[model samples]
Target: MNASLLLSITPYFPRPISSRRQCPLTVRRNARLQSPLCLASSSAPIATRETEIELENRKFELLRAVTDIQRGLTATPDQRSSIEESLVGVETFDAGKPIELDLLDGTWRLQYTSAPDVLILFQSAATLPFFEVDQIFQKFECRDQSGQGVVRNVVRWSIPRLLEEQEGATLIVSAKFSVVSVRNIYLEFEEIAIQNINISEELQALIAPALLPRSFFSLQILQFIRSFKAQLPVRSSQRQSVGGLYYLSYLDKNMLLGRAVGGGGVFVFTRAQPFI
Candidate 1:
């Protein structure tokens, strides 16, 4: 029998070592065992190894399924169902206590999401001629050794009429996240701001040649844009009712899965370069 199968039926408690003579053939024939006579001690490691392999296979399938979904903007209903199924499979083997894992501290690139707000942005970018959306990232920085951290969702977008192709705007949604449970966190919205407007080289070169050098133009524009930040007000609270619940369904060295509580939506992310 397979080790994993043996583990399922094996006796939880170790049976006392017995000589064949101690267990008479007539007595053994009259008794029926609820579980296998074998002990489960050796099967534990085999079961764990099997689970790890299954998780890896599930993750690979999920990544492949979402490869062409364009962050879920173009995913059909059938495709969505398939992806959801795969997500559940991977989630079954989630880290027991993701908040306690140091692997959670890093920037993660958004590979796919079913959140309405994010999908709306993708739809808008596809339909609007002037507005375009780029990469999205979520950065986490834990602190105070309390399993608390700041989570920032960064969105890069551009307006073709106002900025060059390479120039873009960054929208940062800042929130404070606290571990409310082993796999759940409470996110309190803190602020939303648009910052870091990158001016393309072509535009800087063209405008700078006429009046000042490129470096001077770049510096002044950056200074002007730096003033465009604001501190938004937020209600203070640590209660789950005060904010939204984010369930970390899966997390590993390379990928992560975040599902909004109450079936709001799901987000899939892969580890990326740290945020500056």
Candidate 2:
């Protein structure tokens, strides 16, 4: 199972261990298990088992779908487009359960996406993100708003900084973004902006070139929004968003699969515990 955790395109996905166990047979046979006076309906156990089986089956199917795309990551554009379409079509993973907004808080690393074009100029690499990505991630925090409100951001990851000699080096370009958004099928937000950016010697060295340019990496990447280039903002004098919507199709404790509304992109992400 640990090995399967690396099933996504980034070559590393974190999967949860199966801790879902059914009640003991004897306990199920008893009319009351947890409460003396409260009795479980006869069909409860069977329904639960069926639900478990359905979830397990869906998990396996998603794993296979992810693997298929990851394998085709390096294929031709037409082929990759086909694969991406198929990947989006396999969005049966989410059980339509309510998302625990609290659990959504944390750092998440991008692994795969079906909708790359909506937010970028060039196509992403089939194997890796089309950039010298030291690391790409987004962080979410609960906004002091009502339920399902969050402040989402995409922050770190630098440009090419002479890899070999740099020992415990600093980040060059960090896109610090913070935007209030609603947490639902699509992390919908209207006003999107860079918020702020911290530059370093690497970007300084390339002072002649465009700093924090869209084409440099991916346009969608800069917004640091949740999921794909979700809710593509219309010619943003404000900032880049998305043409379609972003759907967090699948999410476990460790793995996340984000898809674009309509038929476009799906991004895979793995949960990363923030450094202490």
Candidate 3:
């Protein structure tokens, strides 16, 4: 990504997540790992069949409210507070470590986020008529039972005059995450990559299609646009790097709510396909 695009998109996780404090919340739980120390094996009563139904209904209501808010981009102060309260209410039933839940091992489409960094992109999309922000997705892939995983944050966008809607490129941020506690996860970003460029046919024919697949360069075309495909390091120093903390406040098979450790704001997501 070039400096301008990076300036607009890089803050998706510019700062490391801090795992300092824990918020009071709860949430309904289902699915369990086969371990003696796992919360699922506890003696506490699990959600009754009736309670499970109620939780599902409540999730549907919250989903509808979030949709109306346009993912928090257009939410009023009162509306944002109301949504936050509803999220907390639903989080009350959350039990056990969500990172250990099998339901979390998949892609979750970002439905809402109050994070200032992400909100900036939403604001930019509204003001810049030519620039468009498409779906934002987070995919988690765990390698073992150690509660460690890889998290990829994908932002799909396009410039209307330069690229087609479906042919827009993606800005991917790759990070390594580990379950720090019952509801907390620490993310250490590895690198950032900008890829999957699709130029219009007219432009492709004008330029060599061979190099267009990955990158393009020519003396004939001095270039009006700046394009890049490279992986850049995120950490400046490994020793002093503490990383960022993501608090998984509430999670279930369908719905998820997470709060950034240092007032980065809340994030709401729903399970989605494995790939974009």
Candidate 4:
């Protein structure tokens, strides 16, 4: 009877299965056993590992781009405007008060205000290394309250400066400004003089020669104000403080021009703000 059953099953078995197993009965029974489960589990882990690797690679690429920009700053001294354009994802914070910056190149000018009131001018080749306590010196042109021509000053301390200098010594090729006025012209119960100064067309034409370039002038003004506000402190009392104008100017080829403008105190807002 067993021989007869084997013959019957042999006809039903596939040729390859029968050849590999050599016994039809054994082959039929083994086909009902569970498939290998480990393969499925292993495949899942492999796929997950691949995904993680891809994500890590993406992060590395982003970091490399930042490093490239920083490296460019230290490598060479480049034009400030060119440097600003190259910093694709750079971030800015406050150090003390706001200051205005005006970058001038020939007849092209860019003006902007910064919140921290500290502007760093770096070449496109300098690498921004991570560190604590970055010492920054501010250099920009400004007009005193008397409206006499533009004078340059160097700012060394403020909330914005403290924050940036504490860690992450970055080189910035930009400008800054402050909102609060520094001069105290108002006397106790004294009437202030209101004078409307107008310039004739001939004078305006003559003054144009002293003006900075027009292209970067607006940009410089805006940048300066933004940086200055980041560093400026809010005072409780509203008093008529001394106000001045700050801007940036540079020479491209042989022409002179204006870059930016800010109306406020040049560098009188922060004395007690903490550094970051």
Indicate which candidate wins on TM-score: 1
State the weakest 10-residue window (summed lDDT) of model 4: 185-194
Q: Put down candidate 3 lDDT per residue, 1-70, tens digits, no spaces.
A: 2234433643454546658643433112222223435444332233344467667777877777788666
TM-score of 1: 0.74
**What ranges in model 1 sit over 4 Å off?**
1-47, 95-98, 164-167, 205-207, 210-242
- Per-residue alpha-carbon lDDT of model 1 for 16-97, expressed as tens digits? 8766554566567645442344335465667777777777888999999999889999999999999999999888776585
lDDT of 2 by residue, 188-240 (tens): 44434332233344543454345555464443443332222322233445566
Cα TM-score of candidate 2: 0.46
Candidate 2 segments whose C-alpha is farther than 4 A from its true place:
1-43, 68-72, 75-96, 117-131, 143-235, 238-244, 262-264
Off by over 4 Å in 3: 1-47, 96-98, 205-228, 236-242
Q: Give Cα-based local distance difference scores for all models.
A: 0.80, 0.47, 0.75, 0.30
Looking at model 3, report the run of 10 residues with the lowest lDDT sum. 25-34
The order by descending TM-score is 1, 3, 2, 4
How do these models rank on lDDT, best leading?
1, 3, 2, 4
lDDT of predicted model 1: 0.80
- Provide the lDDT at 253 for model 2: 73
* Alpha-carbon RMSD to native, per candidate: 6.8, 14.6, 19.3, 25.1
